[model samples]
Target: MDPIQGKAAGTAPVPLSVLDLVTVGEGRTATQAIRTGVEIAKLAERRGFHRYWVAEHHSMPGVASSSPAVLLAHLAAHTDRIRLGSGGVMLPNHAPLVIAEQFGTLEAMAPGRVDLGLGRAPGTDGATAAALRRSDRLHEGADEFPQQLAELIRFLDDSFPDGHRYARIHAVPGPVQGPAGRPPVWLLGSSGFSARLAGTLGLPFAFAHHFSAQNTIPALDLYRESFRPSAVLDAPYALIGVAALAADDEKEAHRQILSGALSMVRLRTGRPGLVPTPEEAAAHEFTAVERDFVDGWLSNIIAGTADEVRSGLDDLQKRTGADELMITANAHGGEARLRSYELIADAYGLPG
Candidate 1:
């Protein structure tokens, strides 16, 4: 594939990527949603997307990506070229060795096309996080994440010091099969804590700008200011994940993006449900407060016709100074989401 070059003026020529939540929309089953995710992986590869990442959201009725390793393994099988990864796995909810083994197995299978993005957040409600960890002591685990991260890296590198209790243990299929050895590691955050940590460790950082737009620039600043050179990086590399959607017509794009904003309202109110259709959003009566909240949420998203979305994304890249932009299109229907990517890819003239 050729280098990414946006067709619009003032657009930065940065790589574009995908972050799939594998949303289970209204009237669809988890199996159907997962199949759609597979199609997205293949489409992304064919469209020359820089990478394809599935998020690890559990116990949410609207999201189906509970097991990123399993989903990514399936995605790797269907797509040969695009990078596949988690966006990401919650480190506080699993043993370090387990994560290393899972992603290492991915590396062994996909060779150099794997990335391991790790995050401190649970990615779900406290109850689900407790269930996943088999412990109610969640705060302690979250606090110990830095140590856990170190342990995971040691396992991935097979570099534990001699006499350490786990020195003899190994994450099978690790010390990865590819010549690149271990997959590239990225620290994901929606806050300054992880931004500073990622910078301190000299690893690439990805900020969740889609939801936490307020913290995006501040966290990126902290990352760059705190950074120190290390083997993984000589300079700070930052990627911002943005919520974007595009359609053939302006009104259609507006409707689809509003559906996604409504879904967010549901999630925030502790009433998570399948992604509502555009028709549903249009017909349903929104209270003044809900309408205001939805409007505020919608402001962070870049949604419009293909040309508008392309220009918006370009301006975002330039303003944020992000090395790349990973778009997460959360429109209600799979077809809408698919078409959004298609239109955006064509608008950018991505080498497919």
Candidate 2:
């Protein structure tokens, strides 16, 4: 039997959820990028993973998931059992009602298998954030993300007003007398502020551990410490983002990681270029600062063979005790990237 089955393991086990980075790896079109994501989701479902979430990012040439809701809807249609959701929708980018309508529609279609993870950060550059919402409120950080979260819940609650409705502001295709209700609502964050907010509001928390490795432990501690029982969640649900890339050997795994490092380099430098092939990354000469950045970030990543990946996951689980592990593989080479997720699943004794 798996060492860590139903119970939380002292050293975390296999059988974790996979997060698709949707990096456009040597692919001719965006369709290829999303298709790879769907394929990965299908593989994850076959492996009995918990969820398959796609993230939202705008104007990142390497990432194709600018519209997480739409992509999630597509992924849901393709897979039968794996949970589908937004790793997060940057709440400040759009109106809450529109988000409600989109996710409510998704819940109507997928029912119990959808997830709505919301985030307050603007997922793009300052100029792009301005383009997304040109109003002074958005530009000046006037987004009431917490209040909007409540409104979204109200829209999803079929019995929000104790069945005797009040105003004409109900979400169509919402929690009506139907098959069931929407999926669980989770708040995503990399800081203590969002963690505390999620705790106070009684919502599940998913930390951006991949991007904010520095804050992972502290944020989770804050969330769990301040949690209060709510109708939706009696206890805190914590998911941590994990950067992983598994290959046939240690050397190859390190070589494969160049893709992710290159993408990160592009992002931190304000270039936001396309996801490079492993060969391309190998060809480029990284500056000392860029090399340092990649090495520093790589410390948080798990790159090795299947067994090595499993061991790394075990260490992470032991250290943080996350409720779920969300895997992200955006390394170089599209085919290799896809294969990396496969290796992770196999290491965990999952189907691929």
Candidate 3:
């Protein structure tokens, strides 16, 4: 029997994957959090998880995955099998050429194991967005996403039309020009805009269901409705990123998830800071409004014992019809976060 993933493990309901935030806990340093992310990726690969992705968020003390490309390079060195991707990279904050070259380098390192998931949002607030992107393009960021996306694809494939200014430019260390050579591009979205665009382009789409639960179905519907068969895909392929945490003890799982809830509360209230400990979250004072907000957020997260978490994930899959379920478990400590995946993997009977 395999030590990490048992050979007798039961079949899973659907493909299960992971999205690592590289979260910095209240008492942990960023360096430690990053190392923990490496461990998580290695574990995911050993346990037969489909993919391990890192998110990109800046100006937030809790999230340490600020530079996904840099971090993905590190993860690529540590894990051999599991697919490594940005859960995703916010395109507006970067130039098309820069992303193409960066991801192109990643593809060279990991070959077909690399995936480039792109998002249109700046991935941070207005001030940080201004600092990351050009001042002239600030106002037109969202409006310019389609054009920027087109340019990015062109750079990745060296398909820029003749006479174009960038036609002569090429993404160096470029992977082969075929489907398996380059990193597969997946459009990430929390709304219908990217859904429609991704479907129209016949690319895979991943929704931020962990944050935008209400829009999940609508956006997915829009994606399927607008889908047009292209070389990349002949049918709609959708993945949902969900917030879930499974543990040996239900109480412990709830406590860990509460820490994440507190962090989200701080982010929503414009006081973003490191993720608090369970004790700190337990001691937090909440007004009626804040209490309501916490309750609503908690409702979306599937946190409990392994069996309970399995049931919740199964139910969510039935409702969403997601081709893949990418879970993002946010706990105060790295061990707790890693353990959550282990418990969930056992519950789902994932095999190596």
lDDT of 3 by residue, 118-198 (tens): 998888888889888758467688889899999999988988788999878888766344454778889999999999999
Q: Candidate 3: lDDT of 324? A: 83
Of 1 and 2, the candidate ranking higher by lDDT: 1
Clashes of 1: 0
Clashes of each: 0, 1, 0
Please give, for residues 1-352, the per-residue lDDT of candidate 2 as tens digits. 2111222222336347777768886544688887878888887777667778888899988889999988988887898877788888888887777888898889888877788888888888888888888754564453488777777777767445644343457666775556566767889999997899888877888898888999999999999998998876778778888998888898998887887788889899888887877788888899999999989988989888988988998889779988778888767556777788777766665643
Runs of candidate 3 exceeding 4 Å displacement: 1-10, 175-180
Tens digit of per-residue lDDT, candidate 1, span 1-352? 2111112212337888899999998999999999999998899888888888988898899989999999999988898988898899999988999998898889888987888999999999999999998999989887998999999999898889999999989887875343446777889999999999999999999999999999999999999999999988878888889999999998999999888888888888898999998899898798998999998898999999999998999899888889889999998888999999988888987755
RMSD of each: 2.8, 3.5, 3.6
CA lDDT scores, all candidates in order: 0.87, 0.79, 0.88
Off by over 4 Å in 2: 1-15, 139-143, 158-166, 176-179
What lDDT would candidate 1 get against the real structure?
0.87
Record all residue pairs in model 3 with backbone atoms less than 3 Å apart, i.e. clashing: none
Question: TM-scores across all candidates?
Answer: 0.95, 0.92, 0.95
